[model samples]
Structures are given as C-alpha cells and as structure tokens.
Target chain A: MLARDDQPTPPLKRTPLHALHVARGGKMVPFAGYDMPVQFATGVLKEHLHTRAAAGLFDVSHMGQIVLRPKSGTLADAAGALERLVPQDILALAPHRQRYAQFTNDQGGILDDLMVSNFADHLFLVVNAACKAEDEAHLRAALSDTCEIEVLADRALLALQGPQAEAVLSRFCAEAASLRFMDSKPLPVMGLDCFVSRSGYTGEDGFEISVPASAAEQLATALLDQAEVLPIGLGARDSLRLEAGLCLYGHDIDTSTTPVEASLAWSIQKSRRHGGARPGGFAGAEVILDQLDHGAPRSRVGLKPEGRAPVREGAQLYAEADAADPIGQVSSGGFGPSVGGPVAMGYLPAAIAARGGVVFAEVRGQRLPMKIGSPTFVSPSYQR
Target chain B: MTTLFTPDHEWIRVEGDIATIGVTDYAQSQLGDVVFVELPKIGRQLKKAEAAAVVESVKAASDVYAPITGEVLEVNETLQTDPAQVNTDAGGAAWFFKLKIADKAELEGLMDEAAYAAHTA
Candidate 1:
C-alpha cells in the first residue's frame, strides 16, 4: 500500500528534469509511489531497442536505501542477527561486496528480495520502491536491540545501462568499471559524490549510482548530453529486467515463494544447511532445511512461448492435451526486445523443470508451445 | 462516409449497409505499443457494442468493441504480423474488420466526430 495521496497525480513524476521530459513529450503513468514515464515521445519499443544498442538512463529514486549500524563495531554482530530472517550469508561477504538475497518467512516464503552491500563502515541495503515501508517495518521488528537502521531519504538512485554504458559512465567515474560485479565504491561522478555500485537489473552491463537527491538532476542531465544516453521509463525498466531473468518483487518473488523454491539456494549460507555448523535455527529454517534435504516440490523456471505472442503474467499453464488441470501459472511474461519474441518465467513441478522440456501456456484459448530454458533469455553482460 | 464511435472507443465507417470497425487513435495510444492482435474469425455474429476482436498491447490486453451490430464478414489478417499498423494508421489500414449491418438503425446510436470528441472528453 502507498502513503496517502489526497491529490490527483501530475501525469508523472517530475524527476529533476520534468521540464526535459515534458519538452520531449514523455508518456507518464503512476508507478510505485511516483508518477514515472512509461515511455518517451518515441515509444516503448524504441526505448527498449535503444537500451540494447546505446545506453538508457533510469530514475529509480523511488527505491529505498537504508544504512545499518551495529551499536558496537563488528558487522558479524549485525549479520548474525540478520541471518535469522534473510537468506543471504551476510557475514561471509567480504568488505565492499554486495549480494542479491531475500527476506524469508517462517514457511521459507520470501517476504522481499533486496540487495545488501557490505561496506567498510556500514551495512548498506536497498529494497523495492513500493515495499519500502513494509520492508523497514519488517527489518525493525527483526533487528536486535543493539542494531540501528537509518533511512537514506536524501539519496537518489539512477541506473545507466547498456553495452556502451561503461564507456559513457567511465567519463564520470573512470575507476568504476574496474570494480568487479557486485562491488561498490564511493566515487565522484561528474563531481557529484555518490556510491557507484557495479550492479543493475538489466542483463546488460550497467551501474546503479546513489547520489544526494539534490544533485540527481544535474548528474542525469549531464549523462543525457553524451548523445548515447536516452531517458528510459518504468516500462522499459520492467521489460529489460524480465528479459534478464531477474525477479520483480510482488510479481515474481513474493511472500508465497521461498529462496529454495525460487531457485535461490545459492544465496543461502552453507552454514545454515543441515551439514553446516548451525543446523537450522533461522526463521522458517526448519522448512527451508527440509526442502534443502528433500528438494522443493516446485521450482521457478523460464518459459519461452513460441511465436511472437506473449503469455503474460497470471496466464494459466496446463498439460499439453488436458486444459483443466493446470500445472503452473506465469509470474512474469513479456516481449523480449533482444530475443525478438515473447518470453515468460513461471513456477512448475521441480521434476518437470529438472528435465527441461516443453510445456504449454494457455494464452486466451489457444495453447502455445513453450520451451523450458535458462532464466536469462539473453547472455548477461554484467561487467564482472 | 460518417465516422461513428462507440463508448468503448471503437470507431466504424458507415457506407450503406457495410460498416467498417477499428479502434480509435486515442484508444490505441492509451494501450501503448501494439504487440499482438487477436482477429475474430470471419462470419462471426456480433451484437451492438459486443467484443468483436482483441487488441493486445505491450502494456495491456483490451477487446475491440463493435460500434454497430452485424455479422463479421472479414477481419484484418495483416494485424497478425504487424500490429503497430493500429498505432501508426488507426483510421486507415489498421481497420480491424468489416461487418454486414443487421440493422442500419444501430449506426445512429454511435457518436459522430463532434460527439465522439465530447464523449472522450
């Protein structure tokens, strides 16, 4: 749920360059808690294709950024407390590294998926824009009395993504490209101080820069001047991430899905497994450990719909001949600009998923042939 | 040829008993980039303002309503391969189908250009 909004939305969020977007005639819509552009005057296909070729700038400022501090010094203290709830091994992370993980419930279902960065001074975290409040409340409830969580409201996040992304961003933070995938550093981009993380949702190479909200527009405009940059909207952002095989919280990975069933076992620390030093004590650890030992009943899989027709989210999937007995349903689906066809990711029987065969997605009334493929429809181009 | 529009944003061109049906530019724009179009089979019977076809955009899935009751005599097969025709030339080549008017009186209920402008407003 969003904070109370008593007034009508202003078409779209103004960003710092609401003027530029309006000048360019962007198509805006309400997303998360902000009015964001779904496409520019050109359209979605063009914006998507542009990101594949040049670079696309995304305003992800609505995403929440939080700083965690241990009352004392060691991050291990914080990680130990966090491990009781989240699936990632925070303590195992070396300094300046980040990991993609989720907060799981007692039933092993994911409450939210987020990025956690182990900083030299603080444990930095970023969560989805829509669930910021709920995530914070959950974190506070789980935090030990000694740990303190602070919201970074003054910061704004931007993602510059594509093949030429590094070349353009290099001009701002030359050393940024040198940082390996999932590594972050405090860097100055166009004289704007920010945390430059070698990360992005798009499978393409990119960076998510967190800067003071005050300097966001200046930095965005500066990047757009590079000729290769175009202001991307939430529409392309969504399609790009879907093509990358990344899960969108609420849509793909929700409170009903667990790290194990979502095929995110890698995020679980080895220590939490039955063989590790800590057998199973985390919340829902019993169920998670049982799934680990005996395998989950269902697992997330990538579904490639035949032809250009998309089998979108919530569309039912059934056995090839039998229409009534549904085996699974689509969680996320769309037209992948790179693949030049329709693609979807959904959950199905783990046994069916293990073999990697064909299935049928019931789009409308016709059954479309679907091949089970790897999650990333295109090869991920992260600058590792 | 009078351009008549249904409340659902479908527009029909009437010339005698044959009425041509297609979604309006406004409706297409709201649906975002057109990706797929589910064209109804020929000879399908349609009621006045009934769903005659499906227009699937990248952002959403919507049904094209019949502006005037009739029997669907022909559907635009071109939409199967190039749905963007609707976004690019909605009133021209993107016409969804042609219907044999069951009763000409149904066309009177649809809005004219001036009335459509007000209805959309």
Candidate 2:
C-alpha cells in the first residue's frame, strides 16, 4: 500500500516528553511543527478503543498555553480586554470556571477556537498549536495595553481522558476530585505546581493538566503508572475528537468559515448576543449576530456511510445519487473505533444538513450513499 | 513454489500458473491499522505497476499496486469484513487476490527475500 502526502517537513521541534515517548516505542511523526507520536505499538485502532473503554494519557504540550494578566491587577480588566477579541461572555464568567470561545476576525470568520478559564488572578487561555503564533500576535497587538499576554513556553500540557480519568487522577491530587466539568484549580502534582482543568477535547470525561516543562515527564509517568491510564497518541486523539464531533483547527473550523457556518453558534452565550445588557463589543459581533438571527447558508453535519467504505476528507458531496452537482465536501473522516462504522463530518447546504437526510459522497468516482445524522455520532460522556 | 517481493512492498507467491499477492509485513507495520480493502474484481486484467486495490487505514488511504501482469482470478473477500487480517497474516490468509500469471518474464524484475530485506533495511 502506497500512502501519499509525505511532504518534506522542516526540522521539527521536540516536546519535553519526547524521550519518554521514544522509549515507549512511539511511532513519531511531524505534526504542527513538532515531532510527536502518531501511534504506539498498540496501533491507532486499539488506542482509540482503549481511550473510550478506560483512561488514556495524551501529551498535548504542543498546544499553546498563555496567561493573561491585567497590569492594573484587577481580574475584570483581563476579562474585559479578552471580550473585545472573542464573542463569548468573558466578563460575566464566574471565577474558577471555564468556557469555550473562538477568536474571530472582523468579518466573523473564525481565526482559532480556544478554551478560556477564569482564574483568581487572571484569565488562562489554551489555543491550537498550529495557530498559536498568529493568535499570540493578535492578542499582543489588540490586548497589550490592558493585559500582559505571557506565553507559557516553560509549561507542558497533558490530557487524561475517559470514564476512569477522575478515579485515577483524584488519587494524586486531592483538589482535582472536587472539580466539576469546566472547573479548574492549581494543584500540587509530583512536587510541581500544576494547573488542572476538568475538561478535554474528547467528548469523554477528562482533565487537562498544565505542568512545568521540566516536570512534564515525571507527571506523565505518574499518571500512566495508573492501571487505567494508557499513553495515547495524536492518531487516536484525532479519531476520538472526530467521533465526538469536535472540530480541528485547520480542517473543520478555519478563517474562511464563520461560527454560524461551523455550527458553533451555541458557544456564543445569550448574554453577549443582541438585546443582552452588553452587546456587540467583540470582533465580528455585528456579522455573527446577524447570521444568528437570519441563519447560515451552510452548516456542519455528521455523516454515516451506508457501506463500510469511508468517505474521506475532500470527497465531494452530491445532493442525489446520479446528480453531478456538488453540494459539500467531507472535512474530517475516518474509521471511528467507537462508532463501529465509517463516520464523517462535513459542511452541507443548510437545507439538507438536518438529521435523516441522505447525501451521496463521491468516492473513487462512485457516488456512495450516506445518511446525514446528528452532529455528534457518539454521545459525549462528559461529567457535567 | 517461490515467493518474490517488490520495491513497493508487495509480496507474491507463485505456484505453477497461479500467484497469490499480498502486502509484506513491513508494509502492514508501516500502514498501522487496516480498516478497509477495496479488492480487484475476478477476471479483470491488470498490467504491472498498475493500481490493483486500495487499503484504507485510520489515518489515510493507500493504493496497492500490481506487481506483475496478470488476470485476476480470485480475491480475499474476508478483508471486506475483517481488514485487520492484513495486519495479522498478510502473506498467508490475508492474501489480497489470486492472479493467473499472464507473463512469467515479469518475475525477473522483482526482488527476492534477501534483496527485499536489504532494500527495506
């Protein structure tokens, strides 16, 4: 089998957990400018299944973590500053709570999607690794006068996700057990001060811990030492998130797509929309609110293939079996280990993107029948 | 019977006029997990180096090329249900298809086990 698209990448950067990954027989590949493991000896299928059945430890240090602190020393200052960049209710966010938000451009196009956490002193943000540099530059240029955009270059991030995650994590850090979904706190882990958040990209229940770069290996080892926790790689991470109906940075949501088109309008809280007390202060607020009221032309939807064949990314979507007209294209797709079939997500015309609708995908010159289903193929197991 | 390997990592075992073709262990390992295999139809004629089948893994899809000129005689239908068979026993039960050898002269262009091992190494 000849696999294509192995482009010559530039020199890749290694994470703090690089040595441990190599020692554990990880098959490292270049991703987001980092030398990261795509899978280990167990392979992608088993790893994806293992994460759903038990707990899986993922080294996501390649993601960008930044701390936003207002120079005035008031927490509201940082929140107010960030509110200008995203369309989320940042100022109204309760302390120690986290909310998902996206960095949108003036045209209502998504620059990047991120998680914002309200801390006791400042706002903490975690962004996609590929867009971190551009995100950093945007934050500095926009919010520099209000808050200090400090990139946590000395930090490493790890995600332990699954049903058994809480049981395995609460043993090491007592403060972690009390955290509900979207809750975060700084806890002592393996002699290091790490910020632990009860959230993850996977639809499963999990925690994302931010530890110092120097102590990342020790912390990962401690978590993996638990019987329920296994080291997962980027491959399983993608499949899991895809099955969960989560969007990847470059693939699903990008600068060309607005929040409404990407089916992320639910993320925009009612408190920030039109008719709310505080309205239209952030970038793209006007266009986004208009789309929210009028509706988007196209929307993202999940696809279940009628046959075993997977309708991969870039596959054209047709409204009918024999019609040559293309309606959409598959964005993210693969064999979902949990779904037990070929599952895919893509943007379809808003009229036909609803559940139970049929859309044919052109694969290998054949129009394969598919069913438009719920945006999420697998029910999220988040511990709310 | 004798087995030969191709630079593309396919293996074929020839016995009389029929030759069974499948991917090598190294190819399977490199491909990681096999989720779907689109086998060639029986009675289809194919030239050497032409695309014969497609293998879909969790990450991407790959094309399995024909190693020799032949007429497809049979296919491993088991792969449609259990593609993981290719990962477990690729050279044996997971053989993708059987071909009626149309040109034995093409065998001289392929590599033997030692040459394949050195080439892969």
- Best model per TM-score: 2
lDDT of 1 by residue, A1-384 (tens): 001348875554445545556666777667876766778865777788899888999888888998888878778887777777775677787888988878788888888888988887668899988888988998888884758999898888999999888899999887877888889777888878899888899888888999998888888889989989998988888888888898999888887888888888877878778888766667788788899889999888899987778889998877674567889889999887778778899999888888887888887787888898777898888777
Candidate 2 ranges with C-alpha deviation above 4 Å: A4-8
With a 3 Å backbone cut-off (N, CA, C), the pairs that clash in candidate 2 are: none
Q: A18-75 in candidate 2: lDDT tens per residue?
A: 9999999999999999999999888999999999999999999999999999999999
Which docking band does candidate 1 fall into? acceptable
Candidate 1 chain A lowest-lDDT run of ten: A1-10
Q: How well is each residue in B4-57 modelled by candidate 1, as lDDT tens digits?
A: 887778888988889888988888877778888887789899887677688877
Q: TM-score of every model?
A: 0.93, 0.98
- Prediction 2 global C-alpha lDDT: 0.91
Q: Provide the global lDDT of candidate 1 against the true structure.
A: 0.83
Which segments of candidate 1 are over 4 A away from where they belong? A1-24, A277-281
